[model samples]
Target chain A: MARKTTQTRKAVVTIAAWLIGIVIFFPILWTILMSFKSEGDAIKAPLAMLSSPWTLESYGEVQARSNYALHFWNSVVLSLGSTLLALLIAIPAAWAMAFVPGKRTKDLLMWMLSTKMMPAVGVLVPMYLMFRDLGLLDSRIGLVGVLTLINLPIVIWMLYTYFKEIPGEILEASRMDGASLRSEILYVLTPMAVPGIASTMLLNIILAWNEAFWTLQLTTSKAAPLTQFIASYSSPEGLFYAKLSAASTMAIAPILILGWFSQKQLVRGLTFGAVK
Target chain B: MATEHSRTAARLMVSPAVILLFLWMIVPLGMTIYFSFLRYNLLNPGMETFAGFDNYYYFLTNAAFWDALINTVTLVVGVLVITVFGGIALALLLDQPFWGQGIVRVLVIAPFFVMPTVSALVWKNMFMNPVNGVFAHIAKSLGLQPFDFLSQAPLASIILIVAWSWLPFATLILLTALQSLDREQQEAAEMDGASVLARFWYLTVPHLTRSITVVVLIQTIFLLSVFAEILVTTNGGPGTASTNIPYLVYAQSLLNFDVGGGSAGGIVAVILANIVAFFLMRMIGKNLDA
Candidate 1:
């Protein structure tokens, strides 16, 4: 009898969870649904909008109406470019701090995390002026550089956490086994830390891809990512729900997939391992 | 394990990241402080001169400054309240033995993945538009007037969108923390005839306190600089209703070219954010030691 009651309770809990989940997921689901509807039908009453005959006209219109491909390419380049650069700089530092004992290592990690706390606007003036004077404005290189700098602290901290987890005995054992220092690190440490590095890379890419502040302020036309392309919809023809949905869906689709994979890493990275 | 050669090598490996981050933080910040003391405007180049405290005076005295300050606080606090509470509720629900738990988790975290600009645009035009939006369609079908969400309640609408994006984050973190709770202890408490409320209040709430603090502080730091949602939605309008410190700085320097005023504003914002960061750094620093 008790087992039956527990099973019934589980069923009740499942129904409630699904209902809330669907409501929360409705907006994204609706956006996807709206993308498949006719423009006129998208703005119709909610039930009708959902039940209406679906079509792919808006997706084609989205491509035809704007420079969607260019913005998409910019997003891909900036996100991947910045993430790779940050990892290159962070890996060595994280390795040294993680494996090596130093007096200022903790202080250094804390200080780096503090830098992440500094509000972006606090230096927007100088950064903007520097970019303008250096003729780096509206260039992909400029955006990539800025994204790398902003995300560097996060990259370092995430890596440091992951690196710290690795037992020093492993490295010590390898060294005692007559492995050279270079090969021990290259062959042993690198292989062990690959999961950490990959997850860090994934989270960083999501951050850079969705970054709106620098991307919006720094770029005008030549290097504006999908953020800008989507914002442009606001002033001109944002009212076209079908095309707008199509653009938004496309713009967010790649990152959404990327973000899902990094959910566990995200909690760890963003919280700086506080909860974990 | 201890060798002079490796110690030197470690330092060499770490120098590049440290130096670059130091320069990135200090250089622009140093310039901003210096510019805050000057009467500089990008509109009229080469007319810069020392004007100590004058920019600060102007920025402090400006009515818009106060509005932006209040709006910034409101946005941060508003989003925190919604997301934190909503997060707890959702996390609790998801923690139950539910069918399709994996799919539900994926669905719940979806909004966080949507780019800020895309989410902002979608909500503004498609969900919140007065006449042609989904909300309007619902209202009209229910025999009611379509409410103009942005114009009527600009800050609230932006807060809603921001909360939606951040809710997943709060849920994910709290759920992570929740998952670590001792199942045996909870089962024991239940066997002792403790009511659900008592167990939840004494056991679950205490367990989540650290994660909740983490969520609140991290969200505050990001929430203080909420720019894109405001930019794309109300543009800090119906007149400064949704303007936060970041948007104000962006406007003063980039839009209006008031370098002095903007830098002063930026300095003020830095001071405000540091107050929160001080506590947060300490919290995470404690975790690092553990």
Candidate 2:
């Protein structure tokens, strides 16, 4: 009886998981389907929509009209550029906070995270005016600066958590072997923490890449990322459902691929400190 | 002596990030506080004057302020409840051995990576449209009238979208936590004649307390400032049905150009968030110290 009950329970779980997973993923699948349809057929009955012949007209039109190359380039540059800059700054900070026992280290970390909690709109106006005055509006450099600052806390926090997990004895041994501080960090500590660093970089890139609030507010034509690219399709010239879906598919396709490939690392990085 | 010198070096290495973040926080916050005390509007250009608490008074007393405040609280609490409960159920399901487990996990987490704006647009067009949406089609097939999700139930719709986006986060955390549970404890419970529900309540829920706390705190921080979802779906309303504090601040400043009043509202939002953060920090502090 117990074995039978357990088998039944397992079957129930299997069916429920599949159902929920498909439902959760339906929108992305639907959008991809719509991207391949003609505009008229894209909005038809669901059965008819699927039955319609697939076409690449929407992709071709999106590429021609919207400067897809520029938006794609901006996205790559902004996401990667901000992640690298943030790491360059965050690693040393996290290293210190992790290794060096200071009375204020935990306080400093909490303060940084608290600043992150403060509503971003509180500072949006001032940041806007500052960027305007500095001629950084609609500039990639300005966005890199903003993204780096905004994401610094997460990078530092994640790295700090990772750094703590790695026993200090390893670094202490490196120092005993006559390694200078630079070589100690560059050679020994960094190599040992490569997985952590890699995951942090990957996660930060995803966050900065998908971040829409600041990206939309701070950028327009000159430096807009794919989020802005998707936004433009919202008010199209006509009922261009297919074209809009194509733009969205193009915009999300790269990140989705990256996410799929690195999902394990992404999941690990997110839940690293939380689960423990 | 060398240790002391390295400590100094460590401080130097960390200072650049510290200083940059300090500037990032203080300059804008200082400006906001200063602006809240003055009569300022970009439109008027040069007629700035000291208004003291007038801007604060106007913002504090506005009906939109309360509406946005209530909406903000509702969205945060609503999304938290759905994600936490749904996440627990999904995590439990995924914890059991199953075929295609990897595929199911990937599909479950896919929505989290979709850009929030694209998700909102897809929901608005394909699922929630009054005339031709899937929900409408289903209702028609079943001989029931479909209600406008984004119109009649704007706040509820926004909450649903936000909850969907965050459910994976909760699930992932709980799933990880579940994986690390002591198998011995479960086996021991079974040997003692405990039923499934009893074992879950007695053994599993207590083990998941830390993860549950982390999910709630982190999701609350992001959800309280939810803007993009509301912006793309309902534009904060058919009225102010879905305007949260962030949207309210945007309408006040950019739409109305009331910089002074907007800053005042911004200050209030910061204070309100700090209250929430206070409890969260205490929780984190206790959890970490444990």
Q: lDDT by residue for model 2 over B197-226, one digit each (tens)?
A: 999999999999878987888788889889
* Candidate 1 lDDT, A145-186, residue by residue in tens: 999999999999899889989888888898889999889978
Candidate 2 local lDDT, A203-267, one digit each (tens): 88889889988888888898998887777655535337788788888888877777877765665
Candidate 1 ranges with C-alpha deviation above 4 Å = A236-238
Task: Please estimate how well model 2 matches the true structure, expressed as its whole-model Cα lDDT.
Answer: 0.85
Give the alpha-carbon lDDT of every model.
Answer: 0.91, 0.85
Candidate 2 — number of clashing residue pairs? 0
What is the alpha-carbon lDDT for the whole of candidate 1?
A: 0.91
- DockQ-derived CAPRI band for the predicted complex in model 1: high
lDDT of 1 by residue, B1-290 (tens): 65898899999999999999999999999999999999999989999999999999999999999999999999999999999999999999899897899999999999999888888988887789887788898888889999999999999999999999999999999999899999999999999999999999999999999999999999999998899998888888988887888998899988999999999999999999999999999889988862
What number of clashing residue pairs does each candidate have, in the order they appear? Answer: 0, 0
Query: What are the candidates' individual DockQ scores?
Result: 0.82, 0.63
TM-score of 2: 0.95
TM-score of each model, paired residue for residue: 0.98, 0.95
Q: What is the lDDT of residue A77 in candidate 2?
A: 92
